[model samples]
Target: MEKLQAAQLKKVLKPIHLWAIAVGLVISGEYFGWNFGWAVSGTIGFLIATLVITLMYITFIFSYTELTTSIPHAGGAFAYAYRAMGPFGGLIAGYATLVDFLFATPAIGFALGSYLHFLYPQIAVIPAALVFNVAFILLNISGVKESATFSVFITLLAVGELLLFMGIVGPHFKLDNFMTSPMPFGWAGVFAALPFAVWFYLAIEGVAMVAEEVKDPKRNIPRGYISSLATLIFLALGVMILTGGITDWRKLSAIDYPLPEAISIVLGKSSALTQIFASIGLFGLIASFHGTILAGSRQVYAMARSGYLPGKLAQVNTRFKTPHWALVFGGLISFAALFTGTTSQIIILSVLGAIVMYMMSMISLFILRVKEPRMERPFTAPFYPVFPAIALLISSICLVAIVYYNVQISLIFFAGLAIVTLIFVILGKHKVQILIHTD
Candidate 1:
């Protein structure tokens, strides 16, 4: 038997397996955070705006599809930069990618804990959720195959929950609920919802990071990304519309877990079915958080190995052959997030990371096209300059919108990332490069 080269690992991931991973990414974070956004922004105009936002995500998916197939390596955004722009660009991209995972892992971990509290109202949320995060972390440390398998199971349950919500709660859709403005902020309400809506759509690009692990990545990666986005778009539409319609939008906005509250209203409060529904809902949260941790850690490991991040993170488990160091780093960050913040704060930070990461990754697509036009592209984005250009514009606009609406918070977050960059430079740590032997 021929030993598999790192690049040849793509042959292992079939399109459906890749698609499952994508679905896992899309559903997990938004399951809970969308309510907070809906509450801050009103219902009427927010829904329309979110629909438009989904289109932007679609454009991003297409652009990433092109880039991932062209490079088809584990580094993801970092790899794209490493190949085209050189070490410094690769370092920045890797840093952004690492931060993306760092914040996202903990945000989801904390959300898992918060959602678990819904099921066991008596238990302390942090401890209960910490147990869940630790288990998934261990699973990830064990192997990628295990992580992907678990993601598939989680994705199924997540989809089932979405369908259940639609089936059980769809009938309650009332014209009176949606026709009137539910928030006092009016136009500002829709604008306010942008960040949260963006949060729900955060993980679509995650699949690209794992392109190395998938089989036939050329065909599978694009299929996986497109399918996952399609599923999430449908789910987002269902949840936003059904939740908006079933309960009074004002009431839905008021609760911390609006989807559950909305379901409780439709299923009747304090019923046996409500208990069962809460369990399933919490399961969805766990699934989402688990998927985030798994994907984020791999990206960190990939970046580190490529010399864009600390080489220490590149060490693979001799026994498990997984990226144990990166997994531990991710778990620690997530565990810390549980202590300092509300679920909303974590979700917002995760969204902030995603937005910034997307902007750089999108720009990377254009940069690569210009710099390495002849690189063997197993799959090409349908409209090269057009699709990527649209994605770039929309991501930039969203970043601006994020800054305009939440300047203080956004500024603080970006400042932190910048500071980290400077520290790496000043310490003379990042100047060291790792030579990955890829043939």
Candidate 2:
């Protein structure tokens, strides 16, 4: 093996850019995917699931902020886990984070296709999905600052679209419609819906994956984390309630373009208002699709740099100062996934990976507190053990629920993990090293 040097990332991200990256990485969930929970649990059952997942995220984000600020690495959960638990633990965390972000990118890409198809009926879904993957790869490889600036602009537009969606649909909201078929599958449906509920805020943690690129990470990372979480929580709940209440949840439950379908219910299927909203709604999906590419590539670069994967994945483009190879590799993986699974399957598998990440990250936080008491923490999670404990316990339950309810996807997730672990043992074991660098 040849010696490899760390490819330093530019520190160009501010608090606003970090917040946009965080929210943009997830805003598409408000447009689609979360409604699939309605198919399993019905509106009320999914709501119960969303509420539970929301609590888990609230606590998880607070605890996670401490790790991101203290470590300030692009590896995110993997970095924290590595610091506390060594190479094996880092591999687990890194692999899970990769699974989470990688799957999420394709899911958003698929949604992007669905949105485009809604606007222009002649466009094929797979082709549109592939186009998005390629276009975003170029944008991401161009440079982080350029990509993040674009993300911020699109994210604001997406937010405005949501607010407009709510304004148009609010008057149509009926409590009876909202409560219709509240728990058709009962408790089983609630458990079944966990993955879709997770889609609402799935990649918010990916913000931490960009810590290495942020300006003044100690001050800005926490603000970005908290503000983004707050914004997502509000948007997720608002969209779910308004969309669910405006019409029968069944109409939009399985579709890739739920918000547009919901808008059609009030404005008529062919109304200009419906068409305009659907076209604008594409911005929401674009924000997330673009943002996830930025985050997913960073994770690949960080893992590769740390010798958990092939070194080629860590190479930076000389002119752009970006992880060009990682971006392309991640985009190709996402494109392949676009053909392999339905949006729901993709989402469940991604959430399974995310739950594992949450559990490991919270455990890493606890271990670090005990094992490295003197480590500088610019910000501490409020309520200490309580917050992380809640996050850990809920994440465990969500993981078990997802596995039990979606056994096939769960097996696929584990199989991917197994393959990654095997490769690590064979190829990465000797190469793994503790990376120390100051940004």
The clash count of every prediction, one per candidate, is 5, 0
Model 2, backbone clash pairs (residues 3+ apart or across chains), number: 0
Model 2, span 1-439: residue lDDT tens = 3334776788999999988999999999899999889999999899899999999999999999999899998888988888888888898898899989999988988888988888898999889999989999999989999999999999999999999999999999999999998999999999889889999999999988788889999999998989999999999999998888987789888899988888888999899999999989999999999988888898999888877778899999989999999999998889889989988888888888899999999999999999999989999999999999999999999998988988899888889888878877787583556663436
C-alpha lDDT values of all predictions:
0.72, 0.90
In candidate 2 the C-alpha lDDT for residue 206 amounts to: 92
Clashing pairs in 2: none
Among residues 3 or more apart in sequence or in different chains, the pairs in candidate 1 whose N, CA or C atoms overlap within 3 Å are 10-215, 11-215, 12-215, 13-214, 13-215
Shift of residue 242 alpha carbon in model 1, Å: 0.8
Shift in Å, residue 106, candidate 1: 2.5
Across 232-322, the per-residue lDDT of candidate 1 in tens digits comes to: 8888888888777875677766444666777788877688888787778776666667777877887877866655457788787877777
Best by TM-score: 2
RMSD of 1: 3.3
